[model samples]
Target: MTTIADRVRELTVAREPFVHATVVRAQEPTSARPGDAAVVLPDGSIEGFVGGVCAESSVRAAALDTLRDGATLLLRVLPDDTATFPDTPGARVVVNPCHSGGAIEIFLRPVLPAPVLGLAGGTPISVAVATLAEFLDFEVAASGDYAGATAVVVAGLGKGEQDAIRAALDAGVGFVALVASRKRGAALLDELALTDAERARVHTPAGLEIGARSPQEIALSIMAEVVRAIRVDGLASSPGPAAARPQQAVDPVCGMTVLVGPETPHARVDGRDHWFCCAGCHASFTAA
Candidate 1:
């Protein structure tokens, strides 16, 4: 049987974003135990058990939050009670009213793929950028493969530069740059038939103006700009379709919040759908 760890590895290889949830602490009367692990996909589906259905609801919500922000979170799910725990910087506390009088603490960590840099040309600057990008934890690929790249750099490729730049722009790659002199870059941009908005997206004379003279220095400046774009400007959004938050509803029987998904227990009543955190709630609402 494939374990949760094995599944995580597969997802990593596939460059899919997911949250790894592990039960680190469980109070008495809870069904979950320490070391229980699960993988939460972007669509709010779980592959393993962390706790009972009610507790799972809380885990799913917190897992999605961690995935959105790319942060590790310590999720504390407590039975609705007056007792309190010390506040931790990276921890989130949720009171599960439907829980069976117990608490579980689960750790949620988001695993995201590294940003990919599409590099063109075999010039010295191109070689330097590739080497430096790897050191900065970026996945390097050929400039032709800019379909999902966060950034593309066309380095002095004498020919076919316009093709690569046009493709990257059309694909909406966040950062597109050309390594050329100011005059030459402007001339190249003019050669391409692009709209004003599309023309403005291309960065001519790429990299920070740090008076760089050597290939390595120029590479450093370019990487610095890329980092600014990612960290400061939020230019590197997730590569694929925008992640949409799961629809949510309240369980009328228990007043517990639940994520609405295909697998969630729900009932249609009077031409409307009523969601439930567990099957018991669904049955109770239907019976009433």
Candidate 2:
């Protein structure tokens, strides 16, 4: 049996984004116990159980929110009629109308993969960049494949610079750079059959203008520029299909908001489809 920890490892290795939700506290009449955990995927599908179906609805919603903002959240799911506990600071509180008179506290943390830097050469500058990028918590892909890389640097000294640059651009990498002299870089860019917009995205004579002479210094300048592109310029990794925002719907039976996905319960009535948080809600709506 694959444990939650094992599933987490698989997701991490696959460079997928997900939310780890652990039940920290549970009130009476709730099915979930303390330490019960679940992995919520980017599509809002849950791998384990955190609580009852109604509580899972709240957890799913909050998990997606945490994934979006990249923040850890303490979620308090309470019954609609219960109000004894005061709101805790920095914790989100959700009252479930369909909850069976119990409460649950779940901790939601988003696990995001580290940024990948695609280095397209084995030159001294490329070696230095790989070392520095690893130190800065970047995953170095030295295979000249930029499929999922957030940044790509061509330091092959004009050997395969054009092909690498074209591949990086086609991969939709946020930062595409080539290490060469200003004159050579401009000439090389002109050689590529790319549109004006695509050509503009490439950074020639890569790295910040820090007067870097040595290979190590040049690597440092390149890393600094990559950091600026990520932090200041907001050029983070290109989001995959799984990172798309989850669609949502409101369950009319319980007035609870639920994520609309393959896992959600659905009903077609009178030529219209209605989504529900759980089968119980779906049954109730269909029966009435």
Candidate 3:
């Protein structure tokens, strides 16, 4: 039941914001089909494959755009004759365009209003982090699949689980944690092929390092770190400076800002955009 249609319908019904990447243009001999698409759920799970891993890499960064402006974008992912992302120096060239020949262009369009959550896995310490996150009034989902934004906590180092933790880091899931020896954390991270950004978000031996021992104490320290991130780093997805931007007439359906200007997609019901976010909102706006 996890079809493109189903995800889209769920997103619309739930009033979530999301990004869908599709293979719109393809060269001959490549595996990319016109309709092949990947829907990045607000929860961070992805369905379908426009271009497999390579394409997914591009999609991950592009999805964050929706969180910023609530705008839809069509990305053109071209096969790099030379290895590496445009600006990145270490990336290897990825050319298997879904087993098809030549390069492919993937279109990433966003669907807005996706719910954001800081998902804490079943760590013994998440008890406190979860509690504080809820008290902060964040809309949390039991499964990370429903979150628009996510944070992973991997405290209580066990065994053979670096891959899962690494994947979260690669996805750039806002925040990540590892409660254990910093020496071990550093060694573990060094074993992975990760970017600087990914490495940076990996807070190993997680928590405030406030000499916490038990699950409850550790949870407090971890939650404190998350709170610190919210206050200083602006890491959470909640509306930001845009909320403080001078109030202007907004077209709710299209979400465009209008100030004593021409007609908006939405006429004044009682007001214009009225603090609306995107063009889609402006378009959806029905006066009154």
Candidate 4:
């Protein structure tokens, strides 16, 4: 029998995105009770059990499904060979078991680690962008902490700004924004050996459609664009099939993934449907 502390440590240290299936409550005749724990790996492997073989099997499969969604889940195993489901992120499976003759409730919550968004800047405007991004929930870490979405916005790309952008792009940050004059942009583009497509990804004058002038305004615009990019790229699931069409294929530029169907975003590149998530991505692709 594993100690609760050991199971708890496993839950904390497991290196992949996963879910937690814990026997939160169980009937007297059930095999599980509060504190009984299990670690649901990204591959759906399970460490501990809260129920019989049949019930654990159900939990294993469900854990994988939840991992695919990058969402948390809660499950309950019922007695009488009839599964009773909870109305929340929980589910119940019914099975007649010899050991656990009663119903057991388990919580399956997904653990999605925060993505690292490295905002490489030190200017007042850059500081504002950092603050706004944090307010909006993008992980703000150092430039070297490139675990997830490493987006680098070159702050007012003046004489000293190239180092930051160079470091960020070299680190393979998916998103790069350049806040510089068009002349400066031209110079940087010429200097960097990055491919045309890679060069195109850089947002020279970063921000949304809103015309921003002040530091706060510029920050808001840049943040809006970041939010747009995040909505377009981040996450495993769409808000739904409507707000966002499911996309198994993603557009690298705008970060929209078009689902496989008639609703997919495709661009006619040399008479071929270059699949895209939006016209913006298509345009970026063509421009590149």
The numbered model that scores best in lDDT is: 2
lDDT of 4 by residue, 1-288 (tens): 676457656655543466777887777666667777777665445677666544565566566667666666666656545444445434544343322466777777777554455666578888888888788766677554443454666775466566766666565666777776678787876787678767765777777757788888988987777667666766221111122222355455543333434644466767766665444555768888
Clashes of each: 0, 0, 39, 10
Which pairs clash (backbone N, Cα, C closer than 3 Å) in model 2? Answer: none
Q: Regarding TM-score, does 2 or 4 come out ahead?
A: 2
What's model 2's overall lDDT? 0.89
Angstrom error of the Cα, residue 72, model 4: value is 2.3
- Per-residue CA lDDT of model 1 for 10-105, tens digit only, reads 999998999999999888899999999999998898999999999889888888888878989999988788345567788888887678877788
Report the alpha-carbon TM-score of model 2 versus the true structure: 0.90
Whichever of 1 and 4 has more TM-score, that candidate is 1
Model 1 / residue 281 / CA error / Å: 1.8
Which 10 residues in a row give candidate 2 its minimum summed lDDT?
A: 236-245
Which predicted model would earn the best TM-score?
Answer: 1
Top-down lDDT ranking: 2, 1, 4, 3
Q: How are the candidates ranked when ordered by TM-score, highest leading?
A: 1, 2, 4, 3
TM-score of each: 0.94, 0.90, 0.43, 0.63
Question: 3 or 4, which is superior by TM-score?
Answer: 4
C-alpha lDDT of residue 181 in model 2: 88
